[model samples]
Target: MPSPDPKIISGNANQPLAQAISRRMSMHRGVKVGLVDARVEVFNDQEIFVEVFENVRGEDMFIVQSTSNPANDNLMELLIISDALRRSSASRITAVIPYFGYARQDRRTKARTPISAKLVANLIANSGIERVLTMDLHAAQIQGFFDIPVDNLYASPIFALDLMHHFQGQMDDVMIVSPDVGGVARARELAQRIKAPLSIVDKRREKAGEVAEMTVIGDVTGKKCIIVDDICDTAGTLCKAAEVLIDAGASEVHAYITHGVLSGPAVDRITKSKLKSLVITDTIEPTQAVKDCANIRIVPTAPMFTQAILNIWNGTSVSSLFDTQTLEPIYEPLYPGLAIDA
Candidate 1:
């Protein structure tokens, strides 16, 4: 017997992203990959309930949910939804979590600290999720926490494309700056992609979410600096790093962050900061305050996620999405014989 068609579903966390992905899938496949109808609700007392309205028996399933802001609530919803799908006899379930929450707590910094990332991984796997897909984890090592397959996608291709477009003729004047030493690898990758110089922001963090005594580790003088990072929560570190880069003689500072957590006062800080612009992806849903920020821009990840999902479903190479020579998206549909309408 032939395998059943793939089914895409979403929890309440990021309905817009899920919808975008579904639209792209339908467009690319030349067939409707419509989102499966489901109802996810929370009780007044804070309990979560999930009900699937369509039959998913023996069908491949993908759940799009970002464990963002209300991390616990969203996480619970994902787990509950997964449970519902599994109980309904779905052949395989993939968790397409654009932003995996508690990822920063992958290891123990203090004596009593728990590895919450590992715990979350266990919760996801135990909930019968057969696979996981996420992007730009705070720490890549968190991939090892999952016993099942985890595809950790990169956002560098997206950022590199945007940078090249914005700096079309001025590529020589650009530099990629990692907000801190730890992210140098990520920054270096982007720099290599755009053929730009690499810089680092060396800083000491006296506490979480705060930076102190930052210094530039490379010559950013007279360069248009692009700070690359995974998450931008609170925006304290980002705003402070932009200030430090400006003081160090950068011509202008911009940021390309993957997950925009934008927690308390992040929008305000980005608005008042020295950065010329902040480019972030729609991995996490943007609030109204973020939408109104004049200097902040949001790029859609639906197309990238759509391609990755198709490649995974078809057992093709997802890494080939980026061309090594040009460092741009290849733009070929993963599904064979499906012409993209111009």
Candidate 2:
């Protein structure tokens, strides 16, 4: 017989997303799959603790936690929750991490620095987590760091639909620009999906979190350019790239980033930048500043993830969630009027 409907649990990282996924699951299975009763607390000394109130014996479990800002606390919550479930006799545990923090540190560029992403992978795999599900990992190679199954979902289809809806009949005027040479693959994928030309921003990062000089590789003159990247922390590179693109004669600039790690002056910089608009997914929950920004809009990823979770539980091909021929997400229509901001 097929396995029972999986139990959904969550840490404090992204409860809204976990709730959204649970609601979607209920609608899909024609039965409610409420979030498992659990509590994650931090003590006076900042020690993390997790307790699952439900009897999860022999039940498939999925824990949703994004290692976003306050990365250490959230990571600890995930690890602790997994340990609790394992001790409680849960048959399986899957870590549904929407935003995998420390992913940028997949390698060491200097001496004596740790490959933090690999270390994180080691922690998750060793924490009684049999599988991992996440979105648009910064470095694809990080998948190999896990000994267990890792499902790295893409936000490309989500961005593609929004792009098609926004650009509509004017796709010919659109140009997808990578903020840096490293992101060309990501930008090019979106460009290919929408049938737009691609351009690269050759940037030289003088130091961590700072971009020095940049040159646009392809012609963006008079084209409505869309810059794409995985993360947008501090917004320095994004703002600078927009300035250079506009100076190079682009009619207007917009951005469609997957993870909105708008930290430390990121919102302030985007507010006063040359870009017309910035669209990001809800992989990382939006803060008050992000919600209040007029030019920054959020697209939901819950529906896509809901389908992926179901596919995994049912032993089906999760790759079929996106149609290779059309590059559109192939799933049941999401609830009408799902709110964008939470």
> Mind giving the per-residue lDDT tens digits that candidate 1 earns over 36-81?
9989988999999999999888888999999998999999999999
Per-residue lDDT of candidate 2, residues 99-163 (tens digit): 99999999998899999999999999999999999999999999999999999988887787777
Against the true structure, whose TM-score is highest? Answer: 2
Give model 2's clash tally. 0
Q: TM-score, each model?
A: 0.93, 0.94
Which model scores highest in lDDT? 2
Worst 10 residues of 1 by lDDT: 333-342
Model 2: colliding residue pairs: none
